[model samples]
Target: MSNPNEVKSTLKPAYDHVIVGGGVAADKAARAIREEAPDASVLIISDVSDGPLYRPGLSKDLWLKADATLEGIDLGTTETGAELLLGTTVTALDPEAHAVTTSDGQQVGYGRLLLATGAAARHIDTPDDDRIVYYRNADDYRHLRSLVSEGIRVAIVGGGYIASEIAAGLAAAGADVSVHFPDSRLLEQMFPDSITSHLAEVYESKGISLNSGFFLSSIHAGRRLTLESRSGEKVEADVVVLGLGAVPNVQLAEEAGLEMEQGGVSVDETLATSAPDVYAAGDIATFSDPILGRRRVEHMANAERSGDAAGRTMAGTRTEYRYTPLFWSDLFDDGYEALGETRTNHRIEEVWNDAHDAAVLYYLDGDVVRGVLMWNTWGAVPKAREVMQASKEGRLKVSELAGQITPGG
Candidate 1:
């Protein structure tokens, strides 16, 4: 714990470095900075009142299923010696003055600045209903928890990981659950049709309501909110949650005159912005994907990697962001994990169904394996990502790959 009086007295006008944002990227970068520069003064600025929290696991029902004791985030002990400014929201950046203004009117100066502000959840345009909730922070989870105590009904909107996880959580908690989706399948853009079908079947078997091809039009809050769907269907529910998508929080960068494209700050392999002595990372960063060779903004894995890389660079250590993007989601009794970039041209080399409880789907472009998706198979994630990074065509030989199976297979 830091003493407010002591911290305020020793505050430097321009610290050795200053980090913006409090998500995974900001935390990782701060830790890396401490590692490389033990003597340097580092300050982390974040809008989140509760420091940096692990976002990958922050679900809608975070209070119940997860560890409630771990309230927010504490970056262990700052061994490298970094200061944290919790509950601070950065309002503006002055490049010429090398200073950042906060919402509370505190001006922070720095030799080097890092932007890892992350992204914000995309909400739907529905009439405000006391029953309709948009899960974003701890308060949202608390609100949901209060509502769930009475064993009420829930209608989750969207089809992303958050939506799926929320639906699963609500269903598991004994709430009458219904998931509204724009398409006929879940995660239509990310996963193949086969995977989506499998997911739908699993959700259905769990007794969760799966309403596909439905777009929520409005919400009338009461004991049960009335939801009008585009399909002329009305869903009455005690609670409605939106997990549609996310947009990068790049307004600060844009206001600071940093080059932005596609609603995110543009960065190179080093995660450096156009402005000198400044860098950007996390969900708000748009960089050229090494595997796909296209510009993309990946929220989860990319944030940590980019933040660490930027931190090291700012600390005068050489680093580069080499990404083999990986993401995982848990739904019902099953978990799905994807490793590496799956090309459109890649053919399905091997599809092994491990009793449907677990499975691995490998994709190949000719003899070279490009990507792999595992269901309830986390042990293979590290190896799959490693193989993908090691070779352009990763883990290509299906027979050889299958031969090295363990007891589970």
Candidate 2:
């Protein structure tokens, strides 16, 4: 093996496509750019020491599944012939000059720029501490995994999507996980109380503590690790983990004078930003969805699909991103796959089997169906998409949605 002192290669004078932020979206964008323009010089810039990866799996499969390997999550940027500047951040962007300055003080130009600079985790307003983890990425996964041992008390803040997954995965891995969130139930903001209650039961069944209405205000690392919620209640843990949702990394795009909407870079159906030859995808891009209005999807599926579209369009393939992406999550023995908008505010309709183990939930805005959730249901994403399309076309009504898309259908 080469010496550990080996230096990273200097970035080239310029690249045809320079994608900022090394995550799933950037990885997918690089692969698509190479596929469309085989000879294009592509570069991916990421602050993570180990470049792009299947980030979603780090919360579940990489930790719980015996067959899951680190190599399985690798996006293989080298195989795509894309140069990677790892452990580096894009400090500045110059859209007018088609160039970017990185944290390492290297300036590079690009023919076409794709700002796939994903979202950053929202953290408590307390001062930074080593005992805390924002827990948004692969590096965080590795770090947290390293800290896991028998009976280690871990305090996890937030009970939303990533938080719940991390809590269950850690509990399975033998960590004493106590989850704290403002909501009374897990995923209360996304799913209805009944399903979210089911999710809470799943976690409780696994010996994980669910602390509701606990607003974590500050963490003090004393003799043992004291975490105090807003109500003056204090709990001690060995380590603290933050699993709150993410805030889109829009500062770079905003500073470049690119138009922004809905808390992310505003892109057309083609995924092109207002700036010439500049585009954005993944969690940082809020694209106009004909059926769902404008939405910025944070899941991996949207990143992959949007990255593919942005790459092709950047390479002169001009593609419209009409594909509606679906997201899935595995929790204990149950899981969910859903598409379009899923929120607590929408009217929800559920059709369940007699066993109640499988069900399909329809989320509607009045008579218009806007989203679908296949809970513990399998093999019906395509059918669900067709259902949503029918709703979009005005051919389907809310009353006609029962059994439209259900388990194993």
* Model 1 CA lDDT for position 319: 85
Best model per TM-score = 2
TM-score of each candidate structure, all chains considered together: 0.85, 0.95
Among these predictions, the greatest lDDT belongs to 2
Give one digit per residue, the lDDT tens place, for model 1 in 236-268. 887888887777788899988999877788888
Clashing pairs in 1: 34-80
- The residue pairs found clashing in candidate 2 are none
Give the residue spans of candidate 1 off by over 4 A.
1-12, 60-68, 72-81, 341-350, 354-356, 363-370, 382-409
RMSD of each: 3.8, 2.2
Tens digit of per-residue lDDT, candidate 2, span 85-199:
8788899999889999988788999999999988989965754666678887766777787788889999988878888888988898889999999988888878887788788
Model 2, runs deviating above 4 Å: 1-8
Query: What TM-score does model 2 achieve against the real structure?
Result: 0.95
